[model samples]
Target: MSLFQLQFIHRHRIVRLDDVPPQRTLLEVLREDLQACDAKEGCNEGDCGACTVVIGEPRDDGIHYKAINGCIRMAHSVHGMAIWTAQDLTQADGTPHPVQAALRDHHATQCGFCTPGFAMSLFALYQNKVCPQQAITPETAQHYLSGNLCRCTGYRPLVDAACSLNDSPVVTPDDVTLRTQLSKIEPRGLSNDNPYLQPHTLAQLLHLRRIYPQAQLIAGGTDVGLWVTKQHKQWLRIIDVTQVRELQNIDTQTTHVRIGAAVTLEQAWATLACERPELKRFWHRFAGLPVRNSGTLGGNIANGSPIGDSMPLLIALHADVVLAREEAGQVVERTMPLEHLYTGYRQNCLLQGEVLAYIDVPRPSANEWLRVYKISKRQEDDISAVCLAIQLKRDAQGVVLDASIGVGGVAATPVRAHQTQACLQGFAWDEARVKVAQQQLQQEFTPVSDMRASASYRSQVLVNLLQRAWYESQDMRCITLETLA
Candidate 1:
């Protein structure tokens, strides 16, 4: 147990490494040590799909396959899981798997570098269809495939392959043995000579944080992984919170949803979208599937990125964040509005040794209307130039009783538009009142000019989005630029 065992299935067999470096990415391990070069590293960040790989872990029903970016994922993160790569898709007789066959029959490759990533993504989609007995439509295939990019401009054939993958059912080999092996690797603490600590429980995590206050806490490594690969920052101590069972729970009550700090964006969005179907677009646009699968809501909020989409939506929903720390051998928790968590750019109110524990989001009331709008350069898998979320409650006569508006990418931190909210509240829900509120929104903050958008443009877009929300609230068809063009 002291050897820092890294256990996972590769090539249909259990692969264990006991001496892995603390920050080695899965792509590096795959190409360097194992010589499994199918998962290529194109961007070295999580943007490109060339490093896509499917991770399978035991769930209540069966194995759950998730496609993730290998380049930004720590090699040790996949412990007690099964990893499926492009090379593992072939049959024992050396014939191409159905996904590969569909791609081959459809001519889905040009440079052949991105094919492996595309194939693995398609494999996940195919498995997703079979496990849930869901049909794969062209739109579904396209939505799942957004994370991957084809520099050769070869996407039509790949989309065709995805849509036709259902023509042949995917038959996975019996993984009963694999599940048994994974089950035996009980959740024990792991630490290497480099002071990389993986604690299994909340108490252990808080104790470790108190002991090593300087140790960087990592959830999914979606952001911290960049510190190693992109920024080249070497850390002496690291505390990985992904294995903490208490931090991964999702509790839904009668009036609210309590999401653990370590809950992935994919899981949080899934639960939230179930209650609010309008979040489907924002969820998909949050990031590509791989990044969402690896990134956490807590990490996003704690990172304090102004353009981070989750903060605005959560703030608009009047979410509360639970911050915890160890004091005198007992865990102390404090809850506050999510908006108050941030103090400034890339800064938060978290004290030393303190950690974000949970996010509590209240369910929208019957008269409440919630809407989130993210305006980005690309339609998918891109950062928002301007993100806006508005939660408005009206009386039976259509008079606004209460309003909360959150705006991002226009300030040092994601902020609530108090001026705009005040203007909307107690006002009639009409075009004139919306116009006045739009003016208030534009004058509320002094947005900076960045590559994503100019200050004037961000302000204009923020006001325009408010207008769009008003139109939607009134059930009036508002023509968009796309519709006009």
Candidate 2:
């Protein structure tokens, strides 16, 4: 097959490069190919904000510019998008942008290695928040900047710079023209023998999956990018499934919310949090904003990581997944409870040529009370050492009607705490019953020790999580991150 190039708008200039590899990082194209060197590669993972850049995707609402770690984002995945780096903020006359001026005035830059990433993140905040005339509170600023890290200088000055975005005159690029150009942007064509395939429709994606069953599938590339940068693995062929139209819809029905497979975690989290507001804190702790914007809920569940935060939450809510495959030139689909999908550590029961299509999350009922907890080293952008999600329905008399518990970081797979649920089923929703069930919850799984925590620590945290839920049920204030808000 012939080789293809990437075409997109870098800053205000249209850029086209020849024969770039499909799995190449956007950071590679920015620094090596286009020579837009403002974004520096720091962690080479999504954790550090050093390689942050804003990519504008034209949506039905408007152009949504989100901060993403260019070091982990796929180059070809940004076929015809608009990318803005730190250097793109300055004008021809050398007048600094509001974000740059804020950082400089606040003395947020020290050593300057992470400055570009911080500046780009602030630039995104300015565009999405200040430019749109929305409020950028200190809490909002801190939440948006959670993905960025600066070892030399502390976050006080960075927070100051972020909170200061609205004070200055908002001088942003003309997005009207950019949105029009984005509407005209087309998906990059595939070469005859190309290892990279971009499919725009579900039929095309399903047929391609049937033809190339061995092909690796990538939506956000958050996990697969680590395989390349960290583990140094290479793929011969990859099917890009982000463009599938059917896999991007989120339908809010009467009793359930059907989230498409390719829906970004940010969108899904926002939708789910609206249904159950108690999950807002836990959802924000999943990862940094860039990871949330790029990664998908379906991708997280499909990966079947034992420590993934989403699985336990879904299992507790009694969610189901829809898997689709092209069989004998026909499209076939099947749905199963989410807890039954996992087979082993990082393994799932998805059949060959099948792809996860949608996740049906049930809405909370009137008598339902749910609580989720994540015990991690850091409150933000950190993996859970022990994660717990419990949903129980109770009558007005405080009798436990039904109970479902989902837990992670304490088992080979995200297991449902069936024994504990049974213990709590007919019991009164009181401290005595919860105390007894907490002991059963610990015995439900024998956790393994890793760098995050010891086996004993994982086992003990479950008891405390349940205790906190007990306190929350009684409407008493506890030590929670939400109080900070």
lDDT of 1 by residue, 134-168 (tens): 88888788777878999999999999988888777
Q: What is the C-alpha lDDT profile of model 2 across 44-67, one tens digit per residue? A: 989988999999888787788999
Give the best candidate by lDDT: 2
Model 1: runs farther than 4 Å from truth? 1-5, 184-194, 479-485
Alpha carbon lDDT of each predicted model? 0.87, 0.88
> What's each prediction's clash count?
0, 1
TM-score top scorer: 2
Q: Which stretches of candidate 2 lie over 4 Å from their true place?
A: 183-185, 190-192, 481-485
- Residue 157 in candidate 1, Cα distance off native in Å: 1.8
Least accurate stretch of 10 residues (summed lDDT) in model 2? Answer: 183-192
Residue 338 C-alpha lDDT in model 2: 96
